[model samples]
Target: MAGDRALLRQALSTGEETDGRVEFKERLSREVHLSEARFESLAAQLRHRVLSGDGEATYVVGVTDEGHVAGIKPDAFSESMDVLNLIADEAGAHLDAVETWGTKDGIVGVATVKDGGTLEIATDHLIVGTAGHVDHGKSTLVGSLVTGRPDDGEGGMRSYLDVKPHEIERGLSADLSYGVYGFDDAGPVRVDKPDRKSDRATVVESADRVVSFVDTVGHEPWLSTTIRGLLGQKLDYGLLTVAADDGPTETTREHLGVLLATDLPTIVAITKTDLVSAAETDAVQRDVERLLRQAGRSPLSIARHGTDAALDEIGDGVVPIVRTSAITMDGLSTLDTLFEQLPKTAAAGGEFRMYIDRTYRITGVGPVASGTIESGTVAAGDSLLVGPVQEGTFEEAEVRSIEMHYHRVDRAEAGRIVGIALKGIEETDLERGMALVPKSADPTPTRRFKAEVMVLNHPTRIHTGYEPVVHLETVSEAARFEPLDGQLLPGDSGETEIEFKFNPYLIEPGQQFVFREGQSKGVGTVTQCIE
Candidate 1:
């Protein structure tokens, strides 16, 4: 079943005409002897392949020149990737994706590469979501880390997120905020004027790799809001914070459950370490490790092990722990390195679909819809549909223009968050939970769905007539729960029918959701959508 039994050379030749965008290599290595001209020729061939595929190319590794499914050793496969990556760079491209499979001989891999030179530079952009209890320094840490500005022992640095007057006065983040910073050839590019839209856009434009932060709410009452940020956006990682002075709390565990439940790789940042003694910090770190362990995660101390270990092990059940302080700026560089080295892992394949997380009206630009591309890509002049706003119907719309980080771009791909100016919809018509999709998708909004769910935490048993707000993608609305078994208890897994008490949404089977009300909380996967 390795590489799904790749076709033989003869079989491949029986197909349609070759476009030269696909290549096969038994193995490759820098150690191989080749003259400068020969190497340049090879690189040129790779470049041509990338250009032919319109900024993407495919390479099947561990296959012979004749296309036989001959696998190679694991080490050989890695060396081949290294050489291929090098060649791609030389060809002004990058090895964007590499998937492998085990075989009798050894291993087989398929690499999907990127075209380095492009107006839409999203190949290396990463979206990070932050979650923690209030006063845990989530926003403050982000502000300091991106702007390279230390806090003034108050909420001064938090202003980078454009905190609201009430938020500033209360010294608590009540909604999702964002911060942008990135790295280039030389080093990290700090955003000095994050409050200014143009300055943020400039940073995104200049950086070779960009890291966008989606800072979520942490107060207990705003758990739903926090879940929206973590699950709504196509995030690459979750930065769960724990203040050194306070260590872990109930809300921290709640947030962590949501983060891990969504299968998002996480990094624990122990903030405000400067205010605590080393002994205190150690104790807090132990608490965090224990908490992570209880959540079935291996806590990795980046301070002890290193960056390589974190990058290589994080997705494989290991969660890195970093001690950070907004004031002292400790452990910030480690985060920067981790972020820089971390690969973009969001899903990039499928029909274009973006959930509307925010909508705003610009004085001159008219209506702008903003959200991360969940799948596929969108470009200016593309005809799309925005929907479920009226009687489960989708309205036709046109993407007049697109903006990323305040910078104008012709198009944006999956995993990149941007604002798109629409031609056929009013700003008031757009709702946070609505979606933009290719007209061909013909999406349907649902008022009810059947799901397999677990009571993550609940004070009592749940039966019919239980009303809770369901958070699926960007759709958050109160829904009534009906248990097929008549009743369900805390920690119990069961089948339930949930119907949106209000407006319908574009709900499809296999979509994960979280619901909460009062002190009850749970997560589930939709098995069927009933409109």
Candidate 2:
């Protein structure tokens, strides 16, 4: 993807002429003086350009039609983009992204436009979360897959994903990391330099469809962080990694249980196959299959029945297993094919809802909140409420701008991770687990709820007033539980009333939650919301 972008940039630098899919413009025309007929003509041309690119097109601003890079000033470039946006709106398209570069003459930039309805396709966008035990090669596999590079047999590829300096120094990931790759008409467009943020942005802009991986910690001490990554994000699929040498460990079972609890369709990858012989790999595979059966999952090896059968029945209690080795690049292509063809199961058709996972403040952009659009759609200028603050109240906020994968967009739909610039709010007022909902929702914060919980593990029976940390979406808080049926024991299913200890949260009925304290764990679904 980086190579493709460089080629386009070089062509523009050398004064490439305008074409159907690529247009060059020295400046934009003022719309105030244009007649209706002229405006209609311009709109028609813009529509043609978008259609020529199969729902996407590029416009090179500050360039001449006759192949001249006559760069314009920054102020002039901004105005030109304003006009271009108007043109796109008139043509029923939107400016999806923009990038600029400074030249000796002036400033030049590229604008990507796409038809409004094309982004709703499920296969075009997908999110997969990675989970497994420590040193199981989770990060290494993801790094190799996204960068198309093999490891140096000593964790060379994992460096691309380790975000914090401590993690790099410790040779393990201690926090959640993100990596992405995309698919074009030709196939997957992997990152040449996975460590470069710019290269990732380029891949997001150029690919026809994208797949985002949420890499979570695999160590036992950071299990809470791993749980947050799984249950908080609106994930479409799960990629569970297991080392061929270690087979299935206690941590592997724990992570797998969380993935299954969230009802996310999952695929298992047996890593480090090169270090073990075929018999050892086979033994590990059998152990994984036996573990899956113990958890009520049907295991289907992709090597035997192929990807078609696994893809067809993955979400229906069937888990696909693929053998891979980062050093040898074995089974990477199969993994790519599976991801490319996997159908999205998360639906985004309800009223607008987004759970805040993190917050940021940019120099000129003011306060920004980011999260996955849990349901429905949100656009710039829409009125929404953002809160459940420490005071347990909701505050009004307006969407100033929307961005996905560093690309500025007019709107975002469900199942997408986006950053939304906000108006009428301070960054300090927002917190994780707070929600952004439509003004019409008139949401109420909840302090207590009733849930049907199944105890997965506990040394003893749970009684009233037992406190455990409950994880729901992006929010994690300690809650006291009282069993509705006298008492609950391990492997028991019963009703319970739970109340948050401190702050209230925007919790909805039918939402799943995980409660854990030390070695004890339980899964539950909210049955009713008590205001």
Candidate 3:
């Protein structure tokens, strides 16, 4: 059933305690004939409900205030929605979306109303990326958080996130995986069916705020994949997991450096607390605090000062540390609270730009490009350019549809990971690192650029003609580096010229990139682009 009538009725019911955010109406057409004073009162009530819901509210059509689902005719439902929209307008809100279901008697639907200015102000969405050493409970912790289920203490919860058959067989993640959970006014929306995209999308649609987890590979050999997950997306925060028993390792340090190098505010979760003694937990906490300070970050223990203080200073160089146990469910509630209140860091203003991280094709939908919207907004039917194809050319395309976490949406703003069905190009033409922009922007691709590089590690001096693989915004290509200030040694910083060995990309100034060759690794920021 697309929309089960029974489920819809239960979800829309206020139960014993009346919900101020949810209203019910058999039909709104009859309300328009009310006297001016009565209409004014109704409008005032709707406005109050929207404000109480933090700029949004839900209305159940074809239902009564007493919680009875007395469905209405299709024609009446259409007129009711129109009247509801006018009433919402009177309350300074607008109809955002609606979902309907068919019943024996008539139809029932839910209308999502939002304040007119909310789209321009702030959105209730956030993204967090997981990074840590292998078998450090990164996936287990995320699985438990998103699914609201405890691990069996032997990698049971991990199965919820490690979707690939090979990954489950190896008991390790070999590539990037994603999980999502959200918070409504009541609390966290526990997604039992974590494997289903539809279930995840339901959580996104029903919640007041949502958090998406980009689970990255943690093994030493897959360091490149971890780096890509951390730097490629528009993540608002980082969740670095450390098993309490094992504490931090060399790989943990590497992952932490990448998290901090990208200036992502991080939350350190010391997992498996149930397996360690109280004294041992204290020791690990001290070690974590020392490492964070060594990396120039202030560590705030959420267990002591609480999530309120941590959430207030999030993204301001302060890292929150929480002791957690997937098996025992320790510190999970605090984590949920912090995520529920964390403000969105990425603003939705500026020119639209998205780096295609993946692509797909549907039998009847044509080509689809999926990636995080780095900035600006995109709507269905908008004309955009997709590429930097082999020749660095962007081809014209129209956005046939846009989806976020499998939920179809008319528009998507910055900080959202979306899959867009595009017209006017073949699926084979799209590749990772291609940029999608407005056709009028006249975007140009570049093969060479100037950047300020900081050598984090190197066996020897980096001289001109040094070729290393550069990872920049989903594009990993071999690039030749020439230090403008002569040869550079480890721990040194200098302006360098870089040229890609293969195809050009839509590189821009101020973009960050990481380059590495075996044991050597360096980070840089693009200062100038030469087409």
State every prediction's TM-score relative to the real structure.
0.76, 0.79, 0.77
Candidate 2 global lDDT: 0.85
lDDT of 3: 0.84
Query: How high is the lDDT of residue 6 in model 3?
Result: 63
Error of 3 at 98 (Å): 19
Candidate scoring better on TM-score of 2 and 3? 2
| Local accuracy by lDDT, each model | 0.84, 0.85, 0.84
* Poorest lDDT segment (10 consecutive residues) of candidate 2: 116-125
Clash pairs detected, candidate 1: none
lDDT per residue for candidate 3 within 1-531, as digits (tens), equals: 134456465656553234377777878774562457766777787788787788888788787777687888866775676566657767788666567876787877877788772132125789999999999999999999999888998888888789789999999998888888888778898788788876886787778788999999999999988988888888989999999999999899889988888888899999999999999999999999999999889999998988888988866789999999999999898889888888777677899988998898753345889988888999867899987886777899988667787666768889888889887888999998898998779888899999999999999899999999999888889999989987889999999999999989988899898898998888999999985
Question: What does candidate 2's lDDT look like per residue over 69-101, in tens digits?
Answer: 788875576557667776787888877766676
Best candidate (score: TM-score): 2
lDDT of 1 by residue, 142-180 (tens): 999898878888867887784688987787788888889
RMSD of each: 18.0, 6.6, 9.7
- Candidate 3's TM-score reads 0.77
lDDT of 1: 0.84
Candidate 1, which segments miss by more than 4 Å at Cα?
A: 1-119
